[model samples]
Target chain A: MINPINIGSIDDIDEGEAKVIPSDETGTGEDIAVFHAEDGNFYALNDNCTHETASLADGWIEGTEVECPIHAAKFCLKKGTALCMPATQDARTHKVEVSGNDLLLYPNVPAEPVEA
Target chain B: MSDCTSHTSEANASIGRMSRPEAFTQNIDVSTLVDSDGGLIDRSIYTETSIYAQEQRRIFARSWLFLAHTSQFKKPGDFFTTFMGEDPIIVTMDKTKTIRAYLNSCRHRGVRLCRADAGATKMFTCTYHGWSFDLAGALQSVPNEKAYPEDFDRKQWGLIEVPNVQSYKGLIFGNWDKDAQSLEENLGDMRYYMDAMLDRDPEGTEVMGGVMKWTLEGNWKLAAEQFATDWYHVNMSHASALMVLSPTGRGPKAEIAATPGRQFGSENGHGAGFPTHPKSRFDARPVHEYYDYEALRERLGDAAVEGPMTTGHATVFPNFSYLPVNGSIRVWHPKGPDKMEVWAWVLVDKSMPDEVKDAQRLYNLRTFGPSGIFEADDGENWSEIQAISHGFVTNNVPLNFQMGIGSERNDGTYPGQTSELYSDAAGRAFYRHWSKQMNTPAWHERTEQA
Candidate 1:
């Protein structure tokens, strides 16, 4: 089982901006990007864009969505839905939770499903 | 009535131009074309122009045609443009909160008045000569009115109103024949089955969005009959779709001949087939999961819940058909002998949550929309039938509908004739009703099974 890693205080990442956790600490080989979205909530997805070799962490965050840096493709940060073009597949998502003042990331664990 | 625009009377003008012609239908006999009891049907019923022309007058003109739903008109001035057979119609709610329909032509030059499919309008103005009509089809104004003779009465120039207009459970229907039966009388025992989709909740039902229309090269009856009857086709026709949906080969296995459900033929030619399917097979999750069984039971008795309620296709006589499970209602309009225009709408309980309504809409689109998988299969079959029947030799051949022919029965449990799910009794019954309407010239002379 993968343990929950403390990603420090919620104040560490600004709203509408994202930060990346290196693959070595994640132990899953893939880098994880943590987003503090415009909805004032924390979300995590695999750092690499599904369309090409680009970091989603560096893309622009627009209202709970992140535009990929290289191709301009967009994805829904909450459910990792591929919102628009050059990308047809969704990026892998990891569960994230805010407990008190700290942000905890459960590596390799899937988040609650998109509301039906 | 004198036509104001035309000076010469058409009857007096045609006196020397032409002689009276024999009836066009003198050659084609409807009796030999369809032997519903015998299970034999002629191919020309699906491909002949003469027979189709007869249908426009005999079937479309006289029957209670489903035009629109009540939810479409939230307030006054809300109007929807549709067709009864080939003629265009406008259905609108006036300021009185009363619904009315009119023949969608300007009284001035016979030009189509309502160009848009649906919109809010207090009045319809003709783009040709600027003739204006109110929501209730009254002629409010006519351009150059004083230029004509003093006998040019504006009151006589109103939009032609439909003879009969009525609504049953928020589903509106219009009839051109004034002396024909009432909407409730025409619906007959079919109303029992219709309640399966419409009356499940006291909260009422509403059509989701504007209709999705598309043309297909097929006879309208082919589509209608498929809905009314033909459960036998699904196990073969939609096998590929079922197979794809069931990657593990554990898909819906509601076998036809052995299933406990029933196929029914109503008193007024409506047909229904409800084949049992396991809940594990597949269903519109938002609709099924959220249904209040106790509420439904309270609103509807055991006869409705346990009776021959439709879980599949159903038709109301001529061409109104709906899928109770898929939540789609459609009308197959006869475009020509070899063509049809399909108008479809998605419906759901008005009380459902927005998310559930959205899910129901998506489910209906994936299952019965113009490009839906099952719809594609049904379309291919209908179009191919029309294509192959064009041959003289092929057209002469009679198709067999002999599956359980003599087995149709009524146990007094349900309202109409019924047989096992796999039987073609309902199809035969539908054709039989079509033949009766075609052969009889007068509505009063026609025989209706009680």
Candidate 2:
């Protein structure tokens, strides 16, 4: 089970834009990037680009896809699917919903560390 | 009595600092530097000044070093100035096109004879005095000859020549050791990879207009090892460079996924890496479209041009390194334990069109040149790591190279010891060879042990 945490109001982000919110969820201290898609929906994903330690929110957004600013690896903003050579692993996605003009995030719990 | 004091004093003082061997207080202990399986090495190897001095003697002095490309010295009187470790050298070709190298120092007063980076000239006249030497490094003229004995032999005063100078394909290398192995023998399995670039076109390769030089606060081995064996970093470090260089950030996902590649390590510390599949070349961007792939394929076939041969890079031990994709050749000149002077050049096929050559040169500059985006990204990590080493906490920090410790094995698919690209087996092999060289006092004893 997971709890939804209030991120911010819808007025904070522009339509079809993304912003990163720092969190200590899963104790990783990694940031969670939230997107306000042009599709009239909000989405959330891990801020760190799976390919490297770059903020995906700082990347260029075209429709529902975001391009990493550091290396331009495109990720599907809807599903967090890595769409290029350098990034093979899919970025971890999160669940988001809106309540009373406020955005709520339920970040996917990180997988347990596998022991060798 | 002559009124002039010793003319050699100032020049001798300069040469003395350059030539004097660093005194060692005690034998360096490399035992902790390298781990048992050769999978881990101490970060101190990159930061310790004493260890760098040992490497200068044990590793650099005994190795054949890349000096210049043969195309640079096309005719008689064509000459270039470079370095063998820290010692300056002048490479020239005589009337017969015979390549020769001499210590850049003048015999009379030890002044550097050739100051220009490169040019063509019949003789190099030292600026400190009017001393001059012929193209073949023969003493030609001296100023005020009455200062010495009548029996003073000018023949014995020619520029000090390096004992060994050789070339493979168009690459010229020099060595101070008379007993050092031939460049080809030293290159060994690495030659197969080098030929992918050298033998790509029937016309051979030539260095582009000028060399790019820059300084970075980092150890030379860090750059050399990364070029040789660190493909794992590409997924993370150069992620942005790949997206920018490719066609609108659309790369051949099929090729990248199909052939992840393998890394190769040899006994002599040479390292190479390339994809296992021949049809899986990594240059899928539109920027690379101008490359005459059809001609390259026809000349070298798919196996040599389509696989790691076309996409990979290698180092000829110590410091010389080059890439096949961009044709960038460089030597990581050690300035100190924590500093390196990078002298880089772009090599292109002689048959390439002017426009294509220009495009290639620009692409090389954008990708690997000093101000290149990718180069800046790499420098950030290297310089940061070097700075971090100054902290006392770094003494306890054991850097890990154990990416694929026990997985290294020989396979028919590639030459020498092969491992998956995800592994640091090549880095481990490098330290294994480095430890052996640093522990041995001389090249002869190292060979004798073998």
lDDT of every model, 2 decimals: 0.79, 0.75
Tens digit of per-residue lDDT, candidate 2, span B347-414: 98787777877777887888787888678888878888887887878855878888888877877756
Candidate 1 CAPRI-style tier: incorrect
Which residue pairs overlap in candidate 1's backbone?
Answer: none
Question: What TM-score, to 2 decimal places, does chain A of model 1 have?
Answer: 0.95
Clashing pairs in 2: A71-B240
Best by TM-score: 1
Q: What is residue A73's positional error in candidate 1, in angstroms?
A: 47
List, residue by residue over A1-116, the lDDT tens digit for candidate 1: 77799988999999988989999988889999999999898899999988756678977798889987545679989889998877899988899989999999988898778661
Error of 1 at A3 (Å): 86
